[model samples]
Target: MGFSVAYETAELISPALQREMIAVTNELSSDRAWLSCEPPLLMNRGGILGGASKPNFSPHPDELAAAKAAGERDGTLSDLIQILCSVSSQFDVDWVISHDCSNGPLGCIRCGRCDPEVQDQCQVLSELAEELGGCDLDLDDL
Candidate 1:
């Protein structure tokens, strides 16, 4: 299959979807309801050119496990990326948004604070990644 950059900020948010990524591994959980109700995780970040910051919550792993745990799930990852894409799109002017998976709520994954949009994005991305096999799943299409 061929691939084209679906989201202009793909590189920026790619880290959250990185394979077996350790950045935000600890935050995600097996609870689908939690993810849906409150988003996956938060992402604390500054400008790429600025100083490093805290981590955030994401849904990459939990969703992957859920999908694998289940049988059929397609919108999982897309839901996530859509959220991310939306936030990135909105923040396109003020900041360079991405899925850095850093600086969230906990110490494991991206630990810090993130906007609701980023959290929503991560949740959607996580859901999609999970259904698609997470890291092994190629979301380059987005």
Candidate 2:
């Protein structure tokens, strides 16, 4: 298994959900629970109205092996999902856009160079290049 990034963009359906997410973010900060390689980055970022949790690098091989040896488990998408699910009752989300595996056609190659925890989530970036269709995306901007 290897590690890959997990990114999710959510659309909050209600002001109450936004407030709840903000509270959760505050709690995460206060608890100093925003550890790298484990806890994902959760917040309303990039001028997005709702929120997102983008785990840059998760299911880290070293961390996973260590945890396994220690009889524990490493972080995965499920971990990120659980964090959001905690506020599921109070959070009304209309939809969520998820991106896992490599960065995209402009990024990773699925070389298996890194053992991925969620192999199913990993996809060939080139296959997604078509989704860009006729969009003009400057490489430098990306």
Candidate 3:
């Protein structure tokens, strides 16, 4: 199934539903297997698959570190990090320069930051940043 459909289905069969199913099954039948089987473990809850898991959906740090170490062992991590660092640095520089030229967040306002020649470049960078994911950095941090 598509991701959204799968996520929605998972959302529907929440922890509450799991508990209800277990309780109802125990009431209707003598089998007590459901009682021993924890809902989280059985359902792979709070996993990469997504569910009524942890508040943070991101991968666990150990998993990420292991993946990065594996990639490093294979030499892929070096190349990937190089490219990512280059791109991220360029984006940071562009964002900072644009914001500085824009003068105090009032936005372009006819400033050279919005000059026709560079407007498209800035817009593309903004779109790229958004695609990368929500940035926690604020103007003050910049």
Top candidate, metric lDDT:
2
Itemize residue pairs with steric clashes in candidate 3. Answer: none
Better of 1 and 2 by lDDT: 2
Top-TM-score candidate index: 2
| Model 1 quality (TM-score) | 0.24
**How far off is model 2, as Cα RMSD?**
12.5
Q: On residues 1-142, what C-alpha lDDT tens digit does candidate 3 reach at each position?
A: 1111011111234465445533542333322111111111123345222121111112234644664565522111122222222322432211111222333332221211233423453344335434433433333233
**How well does each candidate superpose onto the true structure, as a TM-score?**
0.24, 0.37, 0.17
Q: For model 3, how many clashes?
A: 0
Model 1 regions more than 4 Å off: 1-111, 134-142
Q: Candidate 3: lDDT of 57? A: 18
Q: What is the lDDT for 83 in model 3?
A: 26
Worst 10 residues of 3 by lDDT: 1-10
Question: Residue-wise lDDT of candidate 2 within 21-132, one digit each (tens)?
Answer: 6677456434323322345454554433333343323223465466567665443344444444444434443223245443442221122121232333433332333343
Q: How do the residues 1-142 of candidate 1 rate in per-residue lDDT, one tens digit apiece?
A: 3211122222243343332222332223233333322333434333121111221123356664676577534333334334433443443412233434424321111122234665565556556534554344433344
Better of 1 and 2 by TM-score: 2
